[model samples]
Target: MFTCLCLISKNVFKRRNKRTEFEILERYKIVLEEGFENGLIWEFYHLRGDKGQEVCRIYTQLGNVDWHRQNQWPEIYNFFIKNMLQLEENFLMVKEVVKEELRG
Candidate 1:
């Protein structure tokens, strides 16, 4: 059997008040990339919907998704967990700021 890790984390933006997603995404990328020591860099992969417009939340992976069931699952999971924790720590830096922005 094989394993496919999916949906590590995501963000959905409403683009209210005519705010552009491109600007928002770029800002977010910087915010996330800051202190994002994870080796796996999650990008905007359009799995479905219009190629230019996505109506659903953006999905990203924290580790290698495809793996052989008995080959390296443990190692991959451990590494992913480490990165996830790091991501959390980094996010904590700007979590309140982001929340306040969202409330606007």
Candidate 2:
């Protein structure tokens, strides 16, 4: 009985991880769909699924920013920071919901 419970717990944990990962990617899809208002663009590569892509990365680029001018740096930096905080908040929200469902 103890061994059965252990196996069941393991399976539940695995399922939770996969579901949470899927939810996070769904949020990323929304981000990509919405694009950036500050002339920035988002890109994500899932390397294992990309074949010879070498590495996976999710990042923002300068896009239309005039990086040649130093003043533009501050605004872009702030934009990046704000988005990161939002992402963190989204993740926590997803995590809690996932946890509640799995717990039930």
Candidate 3:
């Protein structure tokens, strides 16, 4: 009886884990779609959409002159810029690339 109960509990845990994983993946998909849409907006306008400035502000606020070195600013800025550039490039490439011929 104890062995059976242990096996049942293990199976229940596995089911719950799988369900949680699915939910997390769904959430990630939603976020990626939103990011892509926002990137599209930014690409055309040369502007950072809604959350963009806020994210930069968060980093700025976290970095104090006393604690965070001034030299790190360029590094952080470049990192964010690189990511934005990559996203923009990906969006543009997708828009220009034709995959219909390959499908056939």
Estimate the TM-score of every prediction. 0.49, 0.41, 0.27
Q: What's model 3's TM-score?
A: 0.27
- Write down the lDDT that model 1 would get: 0.46
- Per-residue lDDT tens digits of candidate 2, residues 1-104? 00000001122233545444444445544543343344223222233443433222334443456656778778677666765665455445556655566565
The weakest ten consecutive residues by lDDT in model 3 span: 1-10
Residues 1-104 of candidate 1 have per-residue lDDT tens digits of 22222232223343443234323434565555554444334444334343444332322253444575557778767666765565566567766876666566
Give the winner by lDDT. 1
User: Which runs in model 3 stand beyond 4 Å of their true positions?
Assistant: 1-68, 96-104
- Model 1, poorest ten-residue lDDT window? 1-10
Model 3 Cα shift for residue 81 (angstroms): 1.6
What are the per-residue Cα lDDT tens digits for candidate 3 across 1-104?
Answer: 00000000123233554334333323333332344433221111112364332111101111233326667667556545654555444434443222332232
Q: What is the C-alpha lDDT of each candidate?
A: 0.46, 0.42, 0.31
Q: Model 2, 21: alpha-carbon shift in Å?
A: 3.9
In model 3, what lDDT does residue 10 have?
Answer: 20
Candidates sorted on lDDT, descending: 1, 2, 3
